[model samples]
Target: MSSVRKIVSTLVFAALTITSFQPALALSRVKDLVEVEGIRENMLVGYGLVTGLNGTGDSLKNAPFTQQTIQTMLERMGVNTRGQTMQTKNTAAVMVTAKLPAFASTGNNIDVSVSAMGDAKSLQGGTLLVTTLFGADGQIYALAQGPVAIGGFSAQGDAGSVTRGVPTAGRIPNGAIVEREIGFNLAAERSLKLSLRNPDLTTAARIASAVNTYVGSPVAVASDPATVRLAIPADYKGGVVGMLTDIEQVKVATDQSAKVVVNEATGVIVMGSDVRISTVAIAQGNLTIKVTETPEVSQPGPLSNGTTQTMPRTKIDIDEGKGKRMIVMKEGVSLQNLVDGLNALGVGPRDIISILQAIKAAGALQAEIQVIG
Candidate 1:
């Protein structure tokens, strides 16, 4: 009873201290936490062919799609390949992808990524022909064309081959030209919505307060933890650009819940600033078993016609840490105290992971435990 009461008293004091000090260190920018609803990028994808490979291209016999695409491309350019057999390893079928940024206008150039879609060894020295990039709506938005800049290469020897990085993927800088515009009239809309990247009621409320205070009006309202509604001001009516510029620059304080993330594969443990632990006792030790084998040759008796024999010898050993002792962790331990306590146990990172898991299972850890990898 005495130990429990002492722990409870310590936790109460620590909670109060933590709450008072948080206001000084939780500042963040509005742009980092919230994003406008309609301001986003779109993914564009297209099928194209990469030519001028030194025999590392797709084999026409294995990938018929490559031959078909080449034939179609040539036919569109007034080339007659109808009755001719197209058997070549200098062309490869590839998928080109790019991102169309919001508010992008026609004639704007963007980079495109090219990846082989067929059995191609390398796309090192290849040129991507003219291809139309389409969005999810099946509308052509951009046209991509140029020589590919492969970041890696592949070489073969008589014995083996060596590859550095990804030889089947390449990039073309400023190779895609926007042909159509996807317009979003934010100025024409009556109200604007801000979406929180990580939804939290405290963060949403703080954002709303900051915007309202800066605009000197109660035009901003927190609809929920993930959404904020802002009414257009009279001065900025039909001119949402200025209002959004100011809103995105406003500074606000954000809040985070106590969490502990553990990566089992790498034996990494991360703890939040407000993580706490109730009074608990922990004792850890490792048991290791080792085995050894030895073979010996036996000789026949001096005068007897006995055959030579062999004898096998085996040895087993076990070692378990006998000096391990339980250590009691007091409640409401600070970050420094927690580190010191864990270090005092003289255990490695893997052992610490097991200890943390055991603590969480015993309901002594006062934070959400997330195990990944």
Candidate 2:
């Protein structure tokens, strides 16, 4: 440990030793700790149209699909437009999608996303037409229709154009109403089953023991590392609501597996608290390549009346830093210890990113690297 943190830790330990009570480690809530098995979100998707666009719609000449779809919709409405080519400039084809949460009932409103499916330049100030969203079973479960809230804008001029965010996609808050519900009898089961989000043999055993101790009976059983089944008492047999309320408050420490997350896109790294590393040395270096362009005017002749042409000039350069700085890390060290050791060399976040990556490559880093774009 660094001298500063070591001293602070020493002081804290001495104070805790004298105090009658000490702070305990914080634990996650039971609801946050486990997930109900067999329950999941529902995906609903559909093809629809966006109207009210100011000439930013699909060109029917190039997007025959859009024209065909419109014709089909009209025909369904008892209108015959067959063989009649349409040159519409006020409509855009779109895909509407939304997620229905588990246990969602009729009339539940869900936010929907509408994205342009054709070559519609923009969906700005457009309203989504009545769209039926269906599940994988081809059953329509939701109806979505509302004014789209495009998150961007676009403007054009003879010389250039300006655009911001994304104009071809938009969102409608609470735009879909659920017309069906997925059946899942959670309280009707003979016994309660708790599924761990990250199942561990030790954690499953602990949960089973805790539940059994609270009920004054050996009713909870660790069926597997990922599950713990509990038998409901006769008094609370069908009244699972009360039993869950009581069990959810019981504190049970959990153990997590060792993992390392690295974001390659943003050069961010996250290591599990339990991650360990053996002694190893690592070196890191930074290399940069730069390119520049210079436009030159070429005159046909010194003062002769001739057209002057433009020639492009380019230059390239490279800047290579010194040899990698070797860092030695021992096993079983905490995150704070690792941070301190790296910071001691005045390494910033950007530099530490490269150093950690190199360390992992040399088999010195025990954590995983995840790249996030």
Candidate 3:
């Protein structure tokens, strides 16, 4: 019995030691917290024409640009329609857009979004023609041509019309093929910068510390609250790519300033876990006043020559909210306690918004209040 007791005690001690070294549950990987500087997507845009629109295309008289585009396209195809008054309802002018992903190679396919630029009723069952997508530098990078897939439909008669979803927008999967690649050499770079999505001084320092601990050297430095500069170590064999791959997986506990965001239009409230309040007294109530009008008809006697008149009777009542009382909140109250206390007062989101704003003005709320539409 004595030998078994000793083994159990040793196992319990080891388990406790391991648990103490484990990362916190709220910790996030470095990759999720920061984005590499140079690796990003580029936007590509182009003007194109969609055919087979089933009479939902732009009107040539209303949209003169569409007519001019059609004339230009016909002339390229060895057809002359400049002098002719052509009325075609089977085509639409559309804007094609796509995002060229990082490290994209030639012949790689990407999805494209198509939006009608003219007064076209719908884009369903339409096939986009060969459109050349261009980058910001005026260089052609991709070619898009595919059947447009719209999510909604539009149907109309003489009296009414029924439309669901957006009929003027659609998407085509694997519609664009890359013809040129953006010049970027990640492996050849000696250093890189990591930009935090949410800038925080403590979080940036923690990230730098975590990276240095992983590399067993002080190669990473927190240049600012929003950026971390990393110098590749000489002994790391994986180059820049390998260094990023290893360091991005390092977990770090993120910290932020306490803030409360409220959307007035939506009546939605969001409070951070770090939000707190000093000891404060709060009382919320509404004073209601109601007025009702009742009309009565007054008729003269049968013998007398008099006309009937309508008389108005009004009743007014006022309520001062006598049932509500003031409540005291202790200092260092957490987010959960604040919410529970507010709910106990029977106030809704709109009322809560007003109460929070009032608390902020009273210098009792320790967090910053941000009001959005």
lDDT of 3 by residue, 223-313 (tens): 9999999998767978898999998999999999999999999999999999999999999887889999998999999999999999999
Better of 2 and 3 by lDDT: 3
lDDT of 1 by residue, 1-373 (tens): 9999999999999999999887576678899998898999999999999999989999888898998898898999999787788778889999999999999999999999999999999998899999999999999999999999998889999999999999999999999999999989877877888999999898999999999999899989999999999888867633688888878889897887888888999998888888889999888776878999998999998999999998999999987977777788999997667777888777887788788888889999888889899
For candidate 1, list the clashing residue pairs, or say none: none
Model 2 bad stretches (over 4 Å): 1-23, 280-331, 348-373
lDDT of 1 at 261: 88
lDDT of prediction 1: 0.90
Give the per-residue lDDT digits (tens) of candidate 2, residues 10-43.
Answer: 9999997878475465565566666656568989
Q: Tally clashing residue pairs in candidate 1.
A: 0
Off by over 4 Å in 3: 1-25, 289-319
Q: Sort the predicted structures by TM-score, highest score first.
A: 3, 1, 2
* After superposition, candidate 1 runs with Cα above 4 Å error: 1-23, 236-238, 289-318
Model 2 clash pairs are 262-369, 262-370, 262-371, 263-370, 263-371, 263-372, 264-371, 264-372
Maximum-TM-score candidate: 3
